[model samples]
Every structure is written in C-alpha cells, then in structure tokens.
Target chain A: MHEEDRQLVRTLIRGDAAAFRNFFDDYFPRLFRFILRRVNGDEESARDVVQSALIRAVRKLDTYRGEASLFTWLCQVTRNELADQVAKSVRQETYMRRLVDLEDDPQARGILESIPAGGEAEPESVRQREDLAALVHAALDYLPSKYARVLELKYMEDLSVEGIAEAMGVTAIAVQSLLARARVAFRDVGETLLPSLGGNW
Target chain B: MDTQPDPRADEPPTDDLARLIRRAGRRPQPDPEMHAAVRAAVEREWSAHASHGGRRGAMVLGVAAALAALAIGLSWYSLHPGAPAGSAEVGTFVAARGPVHVAPTDGHEMVVAGSRLNAGSSIETGPAGYALLTVASVAARLGPGSLLKLNRPGHVELVRGRIYADSGSPSAPPDALVIDTAFGQVTHLGTQFQVRVDPEAMSVSVRDGKVLVSQGGGRSITIDRGQGLRVSSDGEVSRLNVAPYGANWAWVSEFSPNFPIDGRPLSAFLSWYARETGLTLVLRRPVTQADLDRPTLSGSITGLSPAQALAAVMATTQFEYDMTVPGELRIESRATRGAN
Candidate 1:
C-alpha cells in the first residue's frame, strides 16, 4: 500500500534475505503480541502462531497476487492457523469433559465411585459408554460431510464462523446458515432415533 | 411440516463463530529443532539451486527436481484407492529410480518400485511393490514384494506382502485387503491385523478383535486373541496356536525390563516378554474379549518384572497357570488371576 511497503514486498519477492530479516525483525513482536492476546496468555502458543504465519508467508511468497495488503494477507493466514489449534484443544476438552461428566452425574457418580480408582471399566458401564458412542456416531454419519466438517471445526476445533468460511472457502454468512441447518439436522435425528437407542439426546 | 422446528432457533446467531474462524487462521510455529530442520532444508535447496547459477537455470532446475520427486511420488497412494466405479484415476507411484504415475486398469496390473510409500489417496498397490496406503481413515503399512489391489468391494487383494491394517471403526468399511503368504486373503474386518508373507513361513497376527483368515484354496480359519497362523504360499494353512507375544507386543507394548509398564495390552505384553525372556506361551485355550478388556489383566502386569513377584502371585492365587517357557506362563488354572 505504501511506497516503502511496496518496496519491501519487491525485495522479499526477489528473495533478498536482508529484506526478509528487516521485515521479520520489525513485524515479529507486533505479530507475537497480537497472537498473545488471542491465545489468552499462552506465551508458547502465541510464539508458535507468529512463527507459523511468517513461515507460511515465506513459503507462499510466489502466490501473493498483491490483491490485498501484505498485512491483511498475513493476518488472514495467522487467523486460520490459530483457529485450527483452538479447535484441537476444544475437542480434547469436550471429550475429557464428557468422560468426567459420566463420573460426576448424581446417579452415575455413585456407581462409578463404587469401584476403585484406576479400576477396569465395569462390563455394564463399558457397554453403556460404547453403546452411547455408537448411537452418537450413527447420527453423525447421517449428516453431510460439509456439515460434519463445519461442526467439527466449530465445536471440536472452536473455530469462528468466519474462520470456518475462510478455511472452507465459503462466506461467513453461509457458515452461519450451515451451522443453523446442521443443528436442526442433528437435533431432529437425535429426537427421532437416538432416544430409541437408549441415549439422552 | 409445522411440527418440524429448527434446532438452532433457540441459540441466536453470534459473532463468536467468526472470531473463532479468525482465531483458527493463526499459524503454528515449529519447534526450534523443526525450525532448524526447515532452515537446513532451505539451505540444502539454496545450495542445490545456486549450484547451477543464473536465475532461470536455478528456477528451472528447482521446478524439475520438484516435478521429478512428485512424479516418483506419483506411484504411492496413501489411502484406499478403492476403485469407486467409472474411470480409474491416476494415483502416485514411487519406483526404484523415482516415482511414476500408475492408473488403474479394468483388470489386474502390477508395478515395481522402490522407496517406502509415505502417503496415498484411495490408492492400493500390487503384491510386487511395497507401500503404506491411507484409505478412508485407516493407514495400512504394507510389506515389500506384495500385490495389493484396490476395489470398491473391499479394496480386494494382497497377494504376498506383510501388512498392518489400522482400519478405522466398523462403521467405516475396510480400508485395506491382505493376502498373506501364510494365511489366506484377509479383509480388514474392523481391526488391525498384520500379515507377513515369506517363503519358509507366513503368519497372520490379529492385533485387535478377530480376523477371519481364509486360506488360499478356499478354507478359512478365524484367528482371535493373540493367536496367529502360519501358511505356505502353496495354500497349506498351519494354525499357530502359540501366542505371538514378540510379534504382537513389539509396537503396542509400553513396558521394558527396567520401567515395568509401557501401556501395551496383554497381546503386546506377551510379545515383549517373549522377546525379553526368550520364551513363548502356548495357550491351552483362547482368552475372551471380556477377559482381554477387563483392564486388570490387559495392562502392564505390575511386580511381574521379577520372578519373585510371579512366584508370589502363583503361590497366593488359586489361578492355575503353568510356565510353559521359563518366563512365559500359560493361564491353565480356572481361577481368575487376582486383580492387579
């Protein structure tokens, strides 16, 4: 956008290491700080995101059409990468939470605590978990791949609607609509069949 | 139609989704070692590119090298190349010199190549080549000199290759097909199974669940638990009732002589013990899935690292298990082994 920025871009395109060094040194801290706020005080994660954005920019240097400012492109890439990581953490949290929920449920907790800690899964309980998982899986299978991917990216990956749209190459509004539709589909299927499978939908 | 309501109506549309999307956009920085490795890779590329001199020459050479690698890479397909009808697409194929492109034929075709296959998409190789294909969600590690074909009706055949099929759940179809030299053609029946095919002996290891191994000449043997089978290429199937501890446990077990527990199942545990103690456990009968999943017996057998602990358990318990080999014990006693 600016003459100086355009010059920097030309230098980077030419593979000038000095230009890259200047760019990296100047922008690295700003990018790190920006990432830090997003990552919620995880210094290591913030550092990771900033470095990744820089490396990606370097790799795809040829693909830069200069349609958007360098800053905008970099920010776009940075957001996508962070969203993917967040989604992973979210999925882990959800799964572990589900496992914990089984232990904390008023009725279930009594049955669970009856056994020693670190003990084997009671056959009945294991069967129940397995059965529930199977029912959930079956319902998941009925949904389209796009919906599944969106749900996974959202709830599992904790990606924002805009982030999903970007990764999926769709409009943010489209993602919103898709999520709405997907929930309806899930809940409809859950109500119709999951209860019959003896699972609380 | 009026009775059908939207699931998302209760939850208002929010901007958090967009924020999450923006957040996921951030890139992940590589570890210091990875950064160093990437730098090294770049340096290597730079050196190779700079060697030729001139910008055009460097660019041309770089592109050529990349294309060649990609072409050599063309031979290998990571996933199930299950011919989903219609015209067969050309997946990657790697060869001795480099990678080649192989398209599926209407009938059978074989291609010879080298280099371990790193990945694939719906691609299966013939028995003549070695590959690791990731079809569907499962990653199947193939042995050298094996013929594997990919078709919709179960990714068809593996004529002679050692394969470890990490087939994804039962809901998903079998991602790979294996025809072991020792055992018969075995489909991925919702579990990880290894088939090793060699001249003197061929064997099948059912890592999880059961594998119905059909012998080449139409006979089939169902091997479950830690059991395996030895069959010749000539189609003579010899059931190896011996618990394949060494073979099964090598990858799955998380224990050692020093640390005691390595997070492997009994199959893996038995395999590791066999390897360490130079003994084999010949089971009088099979262990049930319920027995295996019981957790008490499945995980690391605590204090069993020392012979004293083994003897103590033996002396205290009514469980009848005899040491078939010096260190290997077969559970012959009906009484359950005491919970660890």
Candidate 2:
C-alpha cells in the first residue's frame, strides 16, 4: 500500500489525470472509515466529510510542498476540513440541540443510544472493545488543540513524525515531544473514563 | 493509573508501539468517486492552460505577420521609388531574426530590416569582440553572435540572441528605426551613447537622450542619455553607470584628444578614469606616487577624435601619452622621458 501510494503521488505531480482515479479506488474506504469515527458513526455526515476533504485536496493540489508524503498531506487537509465541519456544526447548535429530539423517536434514539455516552454500560466483553473506542474518543476531546492535532495526524492519519513536523512547521523533536505528552494525557483520560480498557492496557 | 508505562519511551517496545500508532494516523483510502472528480478537474485545468498557450501563440503570429508585411512594403518603397524595377531588389532580401544583435567574430552579419534612423548611428567593434552602436536616437549593445532587425523605423528586434537598446531615437518622418540587441527594444534620439553586449554581459550605454529598455519578463529600465544600465536574463534591470557623459564613452574608443578633465593627479586621475571607461593606460616605466600626485591636469575632451584627443592631452600635460594599438595606450612623464 505504501509503495502504491508513492507511485500515485509521483504520477499526480506529473499531472496525470488517471492517477487520482487509482488513488480514490485505493484510499476512499479507509478515509470514509476515519471520518465515520469522528462523526460518531453517522454514515451521512461521514460521507459528506470525506467528500469535502477530497474536493479540497483537488483545489489545493498545487500547494503540495512535497515536504511530507502525499498521503500525509492529504490527511492533514482532511483533518482540517473535518475540524471546520465540527466547528460549523457547533456554531449552528443544530447537532447538539437535536439530542432532545432523538429521545422522542426510539427508532432514531436506538442508533444514538447504541453508541454509548462518555461512560455507563454493561460488563459484556464484546461491548468492551466498543467502549474502549468510545473512551479513546472522549479522551481525545480533552486534549488541547495542538496536542490533539499532532496525535490525530500521527496515529489516525498515519503520518510520519517527519511528515507531522513538516505539516506543523516545527522540528521533529517538537512533534515528538507533543506526541509524548498527548499519549500520556490520552492514557490518563482513558484510565479514568473506562477503567476496563485501562486495566487491559 | 500513575504506574502506566510511558507510551513514548525510547525503550524498544514503547518505541515500536509509537511507530505503529504513527502509521495508523495516516489518511484513509480515497474513494473511487473522489479520484474521478480530481482527475476531471486536472484535465480541465490542463486543457484551459493549453488554450491559453494557443491564444498567445496566435497573437504573436498575428503581430509578426503584420510586421512582416510592413517590412516588405518598406523594402519595395526603398527600392522602386518610380525607378527601374531591378533597382529595388538590391536591398530587399529578408534578414533572419537571431539571438544576437552584433555580427560574430567569425564573420556573421546582423540584419536590420527596414529601420529608420532619426539621428546619429555609430557602429564600432571594440574590445572583447563585441559591437558598440551609438546612434543619435538609440544606444545599443550588440552581443557576439546576434542579428538585429529594425522594422518600420522604430520597431527593433534582436533576432538570434541578445541586445540592449535604449530605444526612442527621435521624432522621425514616420519611418525611423534602430535596434542594437534583441534583449530590449530601443528608439534613438540625439543621444550620447555606449553599448556593450557580449554573451556574458549585455548592456546599453546612454550618452544624452532617454531610452526605454523592456524585456520579455516585464523588466524595464528608463535611462537618461548620460547613464548606462544592464538588463539581465531573468528580467532584472541594474543601473551600470550614472557619471559624466565622457566617462560612459571613454572606453568605446581610444582616449581621443578631446578628453575633458579637471586639475587632478595625472597618473591617479587617468588610472581611475581608465578603470571606469574600460581603457588600458600603460606606463613606460614605474614612477613614484609623488610624481603622479599634485600633477594638476586641465584639458578639454571635446570635438577631437579619439587619437586627436590623446595627442591634445599629451601636449598640454607635463606628462606625455601615445597609443600603440587601438587597445593599448602608453603614458610617460615628459620630465622623466627627457631626463632619461
């Protein structure tokens, strides 16, 4: 997959139109899954977020400085657009306020309730993985913007430390330090929010 | 909780996990539809750029065609002003455009196509195999291996390679033309001039009037007649000279009898002036700095040809000067020459 991505990047830089087709064929499913996690399993919002990221990648094609691999840069762009979507959603207050509306419809609430809150669930082992995932998400919310962004790009986007450093315009050491701090903070939050996941680790 | 292992410790197992987490953070796979959309966008962009190239090419070709017709008409007019038909053919051959304005040292001639000169046009081949053209309205520097084309009297093109022109010769009879080098277009006026163009250094020397030097990259220089400037390949313009008018043309020819001067040390003054003018002033023998200092010189560098100017300077000064070749000049202390 890495070798294929590198080839796609080389082709794109040379202005090959077909390379983007291959890129979409190879990476779209994974991109959609990443967006799904951020959007709390809302298929529609996740799809919209992924589409918007792809569109932005098209527009900002020329500014690709090649300091980071194409995949890492694309992920950064995607994350920025996702953050913007979240900010937009927050500003509109439509999503947060709609939680009350969900209670009135059990059918709608089922999907919402299925994804547990910050805490509170049974001791089922199968649900443990999902709970841990939820705890990870909750901890991510508590991180400062800089640390969270570095952590997301490093872990979620799979960007190299060198790539993250280039994206953030900092030295590799700074990125490494931020990542270390972010990991500790995340682990602390996870231990507090979901003791089961913490004990396993 | 506090006893949790550091996730980012440099220890092997922790480091491996960190690397794995880093890998996981990369962007997910792109969707098929998204890839198609991006490719479509790129194609559209490339096609748009190609069309722009086409339109620009058409515009250039149109302008060239119109100019070529005008050139042919001018050649016909010059040849057959109601005389015999055959007389017009003598100067009617087409001159190819080249990257250079001056003829090469190996006997290549630059063609000037249908240009009108409103004032003085002086062409001389000087040091370093470059041609210096000082016309009344234009000052041009023609580099080696170039062809200069002047069309419709005012339009000049440096065909093969490089030329520097301070174009704007003078208000003409609707048909005056001059071009020194292709790098910049110049129209001459009653202007003092010096132009130095070689493959390495291309410049325009302005003696008296104004010249507008414009290159392809939108780089331009507006030079008053007494100044000299250079336009580099990257479309950057640099001012080369802004001193006295004599200082500009001093190196184009030998130090003529009519070199202007104030009372300064002869050796020191000439040495400084020669350095600026690209002239070689050789001494017959080594002399003390004292002999050169306090040797006040007063002279007029006007109206004399270069050789006459040197002779005049020699007769007046306590020192004497003579030229051995067009490139080399020798100066000796008259007191020293007589004493020796």
Candidate 3:
C-alpha cells in the first residue's frame, strides 16, 4: 500500500460517523449497482449483501496489505457473501426446480408454471438460467454504473420514469434521454457478454 | 415505461442491447433507511476497530467492567489458599429469611449466606428459609422449603420446590437460563416467571414475559406473561390466566435484594418495582413517565422489600402507584391517586 492509501485506511479505522458517511456516500451507488445485477435485481437481497460485505470489510481491515485496491477487496468480500447466500437458498432453489419440473402436469403445472424456474429434465437448462442471470449481471456490471442502474431500476425492478427521475435527482425528461442512450450502449455491450442461451435479442 | 421517444429515433441502426436496456429498466435505488442502518452498523465497527486496534482487544463496556471487578477479587486469592474452585460460579446469593444452607451436591455440611457455591452445589432452605441468587444478569428467588441444584452455568434444576425467576432484560429470547424439572424443562424469554416442581406435577407461571415448558417427548407450549400452566406426571397439560401481581409474589419479597436507589431516577426504581412485583407500569396523568426520568432520590432504600421500596421512592416524588388491575400498576400523580 502507498503511504497515502495507508493513511486513508487509518482514517477509516478512526470510526467517526462523518468519515464513514463520506465513505458510504462515495461507494454505495457503485456497490449497490454491482449487487443488484448479481442477485437478479432483487433489491432487498442486494441491499443485504452490500451491507454485509461492507461491514465485513471494515472488521477485517488489519488484513489489508494493499495487495489490491480497496474496491477490489470489497468485491472479493461480496463474492464470498454471494456464495453464502447461494448456499442458504439451496432448499428454496430446489423447490423452485421441482416446480419447474412439474410444469408438464396440467393440474400441477397450472399451480407450478407461475413459479418462473428454468426448464425441467435438462440440468443444462438449470445451469443456463443461473449462468444467464450471472451473464446479464456481469453485462450490467461492465456498463457505466449510472446507465446500468437506470436500466436495472427500470426493467429489473419495474420502476417508472418519474420514480427513476426522483431517485436519480433528475427530471423525468432527462431520465428518458438517459434511458434511450443506456439502451443503445447496453445492447452494444451485451451482445458479446451474453451467454448463448438462445440470444433472441 | 418511457413517456418520451428515443433520442436516436431517426437512426434505427444498432443491436439488441438497446431493446434489452429499455426492457431491463431502472435499477431500484437502495432504500434510504437501509442506507442509514448500514452506515450506523459500519460506524460501530469502525469505532471498535479504532479503539482497540484488534478485534480480540475489544470488549463491550459491561464485560470490561465485570472483568475489572473479577481481577481485583483474584488479586487477594493468595491470602486464602485451599478454596474449592467454583465449577459454575453463577453469581452470589443473598439470604432473605432464616439461614440458607448451601453445599456441594455431594457434601453433607451446609454453609451460611456468605459462602459461595459451585455448579454442582445443592441449595436448600429450611421451613422458613428463603434465598435470593443471581446467575448472570438473571434474578431468581427460591421460596421457603425450596431445593435447587446449581447444575451449571447455563442451567438450574428444581429438585422439589418453587423458584421465581426474572430474566430482567424486559425482552424476549433472553440470555440462556434453562430450568430443568421432573416433567420436562422450563426456559424463559426474558420474563418474570415461576416454576414449581412436586412429585406429581410441575406448574409454571408467568408474571410479565413468557415461559416455554417442554414435556416428556416433544410436546411444548409457550406460556406468555400473565399466564400459567400445569403439566401432570401423566403428560396432561392445562393453561390458566393469572393476575400479573399480588400475594402470589409475596414470598418473593422476602428474598428481594437490597435495591440501591440512591441518585437513581424514579423511573428506574419504578421499573424495578414492577418487575419484582410482576405488574405493568402505568403512570397516572400529570405524572408522565418524563417526571420519573429525572433523578429524584439521593438516598438508598436498601433492605426494603420491593413494595416497601416503591413506597419510599414514591413518597419523595409527586407520583403514587396502585394496582388498577391485578396485573397492571397505575402510577398517577399524588393528586390523582388521592382522588381515586
């Protein structure tokens, strides 16, 4: 670590609210955007993961050898949190898989089809769904955080133009213009990033 | 949905990503409350890190204070050699009535009130004897003729008698304090409750919070504050609704610890009184809870029972308390109490 970076780390250890607020304000938007994509746009889970990651990072500061940037360290911590979340959700995920498999039964399918899981009988299909969710998440990850966030809030979270404007502290008109540009950029990048899970788009 | 047309409406040239973006829409902004909550949590961590330099070095205020007290006592250990180690040094005991007998479960000789007992110790009270003890932060009173086995740090077993316990946190799922009984096991979730064991059955009562009674096999039920239940040796269960306060708690008064009220707020004293008596705290009009928040008394009401303590503490302030309901305590202004 550079001497300046070390000092910054020291300031973080001081545990002052103002210093923390400054750090949180600086990194939260970027972290939130990153997590939102990975969790398939589930806002609550994304927020939980982000909070856990940052808290863990703050506690483990002594291990910071400056081998990687602080942001990279945080991402590494987030990856671990994601793995834990994945493990915890195994039961629910299995149930979801069962629902998907039973989709062929009409009486049962009528009840289970709305479960929104990957195709049954094909383990590959399950992997594809998981991978596609990850691919889209990574694609969003590669975009400018703001553009990716707007697209996610719109499509993934189903927020309105006015709602997005209020969140971004911009006018509805500005949001639309950003959305138009973001869509073009996202398509440009997503084409290569997307796994070939029948890339109809 | 976008109300305005795409800025590049005329140039319809590119890829599927634009469609995807338009479809993916706005990412949900993190809730503002979550932002504050996480920031507060992280700030606590940062402060701890800054204070101690390492996680192992950090101890919360209560634990640190307790350890300091312990270190001071251990310093004098050299003067007193051959003292038996306390297997589960659950807090000290205060004799409330006739002599309280305490000895290791295997020992025949019983010691006096000042004597310390270990986890495997057996505590017995004579016909008129009463004893008060604290295990961790939990407060418990052993009624007259009661016998309890100090099994260990996390558990106390009722051999044959009644025991009143108040977890004292005023919250549910309190620290672990398991009360093992013949019919089953009884535990509390931060409650003021009582458990009695007889050869034929076990009875559990709640005054303020809750108690969990597990019977033989897998049967268990939660008895909330102001409720009571009985489990027969034959595995039958019956529930009863009981007053939160009154004579049922009178025996506990004999074992009430000397509460230090000097320089404490009236509210603190009142809360102690309510918990000890198992009544709801209801402050009368004109004597709001705020009135009790300020320091009122500078003298200790030491040695006074919970009821007597309340009287002494209330006399100084303008508030007077009475039981409007068996379970509810109404502490109104002196004027209001007098009027009714």
Candidate 4:
C-alpha cells in the first residue's frame, strides 16, 4: 500500500527484468525464512513452497493493486500453498487407509514399515509419535470446518484471539467462544478414540 | 446436530500453550543454494511469459498440442483387437520367471526364454510369478498376476495387473509404445513408467520423461517425470508426487531384468542402465562425452538392478553417480582418475 511499493509493482508489471531481479534479491531471503519456519525445517518443502509462491507472484504481478505490502501478499501466497500441501498429504493418508481397510494386510503393513524414522530415533518411538499425530489430525477432522479453521488459526498459524477474530470477520469474544467449543469437541473425539491420552492430557 | 458453544466455558489456550504453538514454528533456515534456485526459477517464469507474449498464449498453445497428441493416441488404441501388427513376433523373450504363459486367441501356451511373441499372444503370469521380455530395445517387466496382449495398432493392452515398461535410449523412437487400459491410454517418449490396472482403478506412474495419459474424448493430461495419477473407473483422477527409487517402487526394482555392462562402452552401458532405472544420465564437468565414449568398462553386473549396479560399478570406476533429482542420475568424474 506504500507509494514506493506501488511504483515497484508498476515497474514489475511493465516487464522490467532488472526491477524484477532487484525485487527477487530483496524478498527471496525473507520469503524463504518464513516458509522454512512454517515447514518445520524441511528444506525441500521450504524451497518448493517458496518457488511456487514466487512463480504465482510473478504471474499475478499485474493484478497486484498494492493494497498490502508486497511481502505480506507473498506470505499469503505461501500460506495457501502450504495448506494445499497439507490437504494433499491428508488425502494420500486417506487413500492409503482405504487401500487395505479390509483387515490390515501384513504385506501392506510391511511396505509402510520401510519408511525411515529420521535421526537416531527408534522406529517404535517414531511410530508412537505418528500415532499421536494421527489421532490429533483425526480429532481435528471430526470438527466442523469453521471450527477447525479457527483452531488452525489459533494453533497452527499462532494467530492471536484478536487476529483470529479479524481473519474470521468476527469479534474477539466470538473467537474465544469458538476456540473453547473446538477444544471441547476435539477432546471428546480424542477421548472416544484413545482414552489413556484423554485422562493424562 | 446440536450446535452451541458451552455457556459455562469460554476459554483459549493458556500462554504456555501458546508458547508451545510458537515453538512449533521455530525451524532452521534453508540452504542458500535452495534460495538461489527458487529465485532463478522465478526469473525463468518471467522470461518465458515475455517470450510467449503472455502466460495465456503459452497455455493455449500447450493445451492444443496436448489435445492433438491425445487424439492420435486414442485413435491408435481404439483399433480392432486381436489383429496382427505387422509380423507376428515383436521380439523374443530374453528372461522369464515363474509360471509365465502366453494365451493366444485360439489356445494357451507357456512362454520360455527366447520365445517370440505375436500380436494375438496374451502374456500372463500366475501367483508369485513375473516375466521380463524385451520387445525391441525396449524392456518391459510383467509383474505377478498380470495379463497383457500386444494389440494390432502398435499398443499393448493390459487387461489387469502391473507392467513396468522402459523404452530404452532417448534416441530410440517411441513408435511402438502405447499401453491401453480400461480407464485410459498411456503413451510415453523413451521413458520409464509403471501401469497398474486393478478391477477398480488404473494407476500410471511416470518415473522419467513424459507420458500422455488420455481418458478419451480429448481429455488428456501429460504426467511428467516424478508424477503419478490414479484414475478410478468413473474417470476420477488423483495425482501424487512419486519418489521413483523409494520403497514404493521396491516391487518394480525387484522385477528389473539383467542389464549387462561387461565389455561395453561406459557411455552405452550408462545410458542403458539409466534408462532401465528411470534415470537421466548427467555427465558433469571434467567428465566429458569423450570419457563416456572411450572408456570400455570391463566388469560384470550380474543380478543387481540398474541403480544398485551403478553404485557397485561406479565405485570401481573413476566416475561417481548420484540421484540428483527424482529420476536423474548425474555422473561426476573426479580429479583423481580410476578407482581411487
């Protein structure tokens, strides 16, 4: 929205390669750092998300009305791309579950066993961690989409109550109410699925 | 469904819990090379858009070309079945394992090593069985429980089960490569790919090069290397990125036929090995084409797949190879020559 960024946008849209290169030098590190944190130190994913974000940014530069700082716009693109990746992974997990839902065929389980646990962690520990994460993901899946979205903003994006309210176009009190209900439902689902964790947590 | 927030409890995660959330986001920065590569890609996209007049024009041209290719492939597969394609024999079977059989339109017969197959021949395998046959320079591995019939119109019909096909050498024309499935037609250009057809859905995973996957009526999508698509019977397609050499491809690796490198030029051997393993052989600086051409590798790779064989053999040679991308094999020639 600044006058300076608006001029840069005008230059970028005019097919000025030098201007674009300058923009890349200015923004690549900032964008890469943001995506790196979001992807939990997964360098490969950070690179992919940043590349995709930059490509979209370049292609849609003409449509950039300079309503927000260019970096903010780029971050929004990266967030959407990261969400797409998560949803894709969820779909793959769902598909794999459906593949051998019959009786948990040992042959299929053998294929899954080959997946490395990373670092020096034991396979059993990794499996336990994955199992807990799966349970949490399942609980989240059971919540209404609106409820899940609020919780994701609160937890995953680390947005504040007021920020969540602003993002959801609601009041902070309403956001508080939504978060409380989401947590309760998430707990109920987790309890019905795995009771030991329910009591301990 | 009852929809109401509890009146008694209106709360959020405590400050400590919020700290936990923030901790989740703490991650180390990516490598500088990765950032540079991404920046370069953005520049390339911008240049491409400018060169093609615009992204819209480029996309239109790409879609038009894709549609033309798909139409040709669909017409190729829709030819009459059981018709002989030129001479009866495409090529002789170089290797076969377990109970491999070929059932013609009239009767059934067992397939053996060096046995030639014709258009009417329906190749099959029983439980815990597989077959590897070389049809031209191209090598195809028929996995267990597969039934394949070489069709008349220059395509192989996979009735069901899995087939790993690698059209050897990028120079070899893709004139004879078409895999017909119930869901669609899969054609590739000197590539390594696997087509698995079950009773419910058909999946095509490309390891290298590009594959034209046509679901008929001009509906086709070009799946590039490291990408896979699963098409349900209702023509629903879901794509996933493929790690070609990962555990997901272990079964395919187990079925790879022997690639002899003894008394062969290093270049030819590497090209064949890379093609079979779905790797694009890259020769780095100091490793010229002359090195690939002149060096006559004198070794034996008996039972290993292309990837394993490359590892074991490259250790004995001056060249070192690594998987640079999902399906690329980059060979780096070291400064100190020979096995050091």
Best by DockQ: 3
RMSD of 4: 24.2
User: Against the hidden reference, what TM-scores do the models get?
Assistant: 0.27, 0.25, 0.44, 0.42
True contacts kept of each: 0.04, 0.11, 0.38, 0.29
List the RMSD of every prediction in angstroms: 25.8, 27.3, 25.3, 24.2
Model 2 agreement with the true structure over A59-155: per-residue lDDT tens digits: 5565666676565676678788788887885633654554455567889767656765454553363366554455454455444445656777776
i-RMS for every candidate (Å) is 18.9, 15.9, 17.3, 15.9
Kindly report which residue stretches of model 4 are placed more than 4 angstroms away from their true locations once superposed. A1-201, B1-91, B105-110, B134-138, B169-175, B216-218, B243-245, B280-287, B320-340
What is the clash tally of candidate 2? Answer: 62
Best model per lDDT: 3
Clashing pairs in 4: none
Report how far off residue B89 is in candidate 1 (Å).
7.6
Model number with the top TM-score: 3
Off by over 4 Å in 1: A1-201, B1-131, B144-147, B151-153, B168-183, B199-201, B216-218, B242-340
Residue B263, candidate 3: C-alpha displacement in angstroms: 0.7
lDDT of 1 at B308: 39
Q: lDDT per model, in order?
A: 0.46, 0.46, 0.63, 0.62
Task: Tell me how far the alpha carbon of residue A12 in candidate 3 is from the true structure, in angstroms, after superposition.
Answer: 71
